[model samples]
Target: MMANTNGYLVGSNLERVLKAGHFAVTAELGPPQSAEGDVIRKKAGLLRGYCDAVNLTDNQTAIVRLSSIAAGAILVQEGLEPIIQMTCRDRNRLAIQSDLLGAAALGIRNLLCLTGDHQTFGNHPSAKNVFDIDSLQMVQMVTAMRDERTFQCGDSFKGPEPRFFVGAAAAPFADPVDFRPLRLAKKAKAGANFIQTQLVYDIPAFEKFMAKVRALGVHKQTYILAGVGPLKSPAMAKYMKSNVPGILVPDELIERMELAGAPWAGKSKEELTKDDKKARSAAWQAEGIQICIELINKLHQIEGVSGVHIMAIEWEDAVRPIVEGAGLSPRPVVTESPPLAAALG
Candidate 1:
């Protein structure tokens, strides 16, 4: 597959796109919280020239996104490979199927299928949650459409179905560990080509999850990505601890952060008036960073997990440094021929 004028490979679909390997890194370019095109375009361009691909989040955080497809089109204009994420919360099967075809026709093939957060989780509390299907089902639907050229309603191919590298989410730290292995297997069985895991903090738990997959012996069959992020502030830590699902913020870590921040959290704004420096650098580098680096190494060392997809969210701008710091090099960009003129009579 060759790059478009902006440099993103124009024809590279899912399968070839991920094979560049080496801790396959992807960063999210969330749609604007409003209809602001300039803001979204800026975020898209910020990460445009780097990373394996950019994920345009769909109504992420249940807030209104500029629509993943629209953002993706803009990213394509900017020359970034865009992964158009689709959620089941707002759309039903017909809509989901319709969007898949639309996305492909628009030159976006990478897909991240999410069951979406419930509507109550967002600012618009009155919005309805449409759980028409779970994440795995959505993956299955995409698989059928791509591979069999058919829809859930048994529609036959009028022409060709778009090829997609279908991805699903796995919350390693989310509620009920029993569900982890089961869901992973179901998603794999349902034809999920890859998985982007939830944010991971406890390396031991993360390792155990891998071990469980190993015991199941299907480790080599799926692409597993380890999600990592740095705590922005103590306030952010508190919010994650109380609100986020399937996420456990160890009390000790919080206490350590508090101690690191010392009087900062409690300090009056006046006290820091003269010093605008951060209260403290959250020690994400201490052992924790190494632990993730080790996990990346192990995932590489192991047979089942093909690669890791780093999700820094807004902090994604720091991803290249982390990947390099972890000793992985940037993937060589693919070359493309200049656009050809149409055949004449």
Candidate 2:
């Protein structure tokens, strides 16, 4: 099989675009908590043509939502490329491998592997955890299936195997921050072709993390897309800082949100009509978008950085403006091809 410039035997348009040296763009969309396909389609429509690919999150925050693979298949049917996220929180290796085969069968070509948030964070706090394999092992298992044509048990497949452009996540701002880069290096060595980091707000800290990554030469081995998003409100910022693990929201950003909402900050619920509160909230969101755009511009210049992954996080409508604002609109046209398994067959 002929490999693309990025050196993967099987590559999607995303891989080809990145391999051809375009600044790749990806976005995330959480499937609706309900089983309504229309909701998923609606959100997916908002992202189409705005990004190279859209990520269908896998039970993000451990909340029950439409299955990622199922949602991805819907997006595929809508003529959009979907990166089906798979988390190990709910499934063992058996289910993981089974779903990978099914996802590829449905024409889903990209995947983002993650060790999902603990169930305690979800609506189902009493649910049992089934982390049969960590995210690193998940990467290795999928790589084996794709590149080695073998199952996790080392059993060779008698037929076609799933071909995926595998990805993993990195948290640059996580505790024991100094060790973060090394964790990334381990994932790269384990066969992760690309990485999308956790939400990044503190650039200086991210730059330091990238410095260590470059020093180790892992950047050369895998493409790194810094994660970024728009903060909806000052309360949202505070909640994330206090509740979400590994997220770093600078106090200056919180102050900016407060200032944006200052007009109505002093007003009581009775004094401020719904419109007044809506207008003030919009201000905070607007400032948040601006900050996100600035971060994208800065991250582009960082060495070893390949692209930005915009995670609007329920703010799907904001994606178009953010991408256009950052001058990333009119995404490059890249040719797509059949999966490696089918093409080779």
Candidate 3:
């Protein structure tokens, strides 16, 4: 593990890459439901070098999975940096801080604080939740831990404190549309160093949102990484557009996905053979990747966007082509700098 001698918070690779002004790329790595380190290692192989760092989701969707910190440690061993996600759904402040210390001890330096999805949506629908603190408070808690070397209760650490490059989520098109920007401002005010947004398919809407963001000057306070992903099928696209909260998939993109299946457009399920369905699936995926590449290009032109977060979800292989197609391959490597105090001297 590298020492905290760099003139940056935590000195994580993600922070350095963004500080260097590179349009950074980050991807999601969903840990398996079982206790298999090999699953994480295999996913790391797919993302290594294609992104600055990969986010290990913390029991995403409130389902049980290999712990994010544990999966992150595996990523660290694989020579890939990890952004460990900490959710407020399952743990209280004490558990959160303890796990954070464990993560930092294991060489993980990036943290994404999230108010996780409700437990009713997951397999454990009857499970009790522990929302001791929301994401905003979680951000403030970690920030205090890193900056002031104090616990959430304001108690000073007896030993070296955990340092992190803290992150929070943003949803541009969520409900109360007019207030999304203000919600983001609150996160920035709470001390988020970076913001990874919800999936953005409605470019025009996102542009309008950024207009407000820039007006409030939140972008200048923290780095914003636009989230993107490849649609597996037209059904998948439609489902997200109609069902998912905070995600707005444009009608044109859904139409594009539908058009990709033009060959079997009117065919009934019984009429379509296995091979026909398979072929159509491939075509839709190809179009999806192309669409993602185009979105990345457009996002690059958006003024406040610092980079992109590709949420390829379960389809890790799509990241390579999507990144390469967008001409963001061969990611930059930024060397470490002296600590802040030493640099000041």
User: All candidates' TM-scores?
Assistant: 0.83, 0.94, 0.96
The sequence of per-residue lDDT tens digits that candidate 2 reaches over residues 1-345 is 322424445567778767767788899999998989999889988998999889999999989999999999999899888989999999999999998999989998898999999999899999999999999999999988988889999999887889898999999988888899999999999999889999988888889899999999998888899999988999999999888788989899889889999989899889999899889978988998988998899998899888999999889998998899899998888665433432210
How many times do residue backbones clash in model 2?
A: 0
Q: Which candidate is the best by TM-score?
A: 3
Candidate 3 displacement at residue 206 in angstroms: 0.3
Whose lDDT is higher: candidate 1's or candidate 2's? 2
Candidate 1 total steric clashes? 5
Clash number for model 3? 0
lDDT score for residue 337 of model 2? 46
- Error at 171, model 1, angstroms: 1.0
Q: Write the per-residue lDDT of candidate 1 for residues 83-181, one digit (tens) a residue.
A: 888999999999999888888888887888998877787888798788898888899998888777789888876866866778888887776886787
Predicted structure with the largest lDDT when compared to the true one: 3
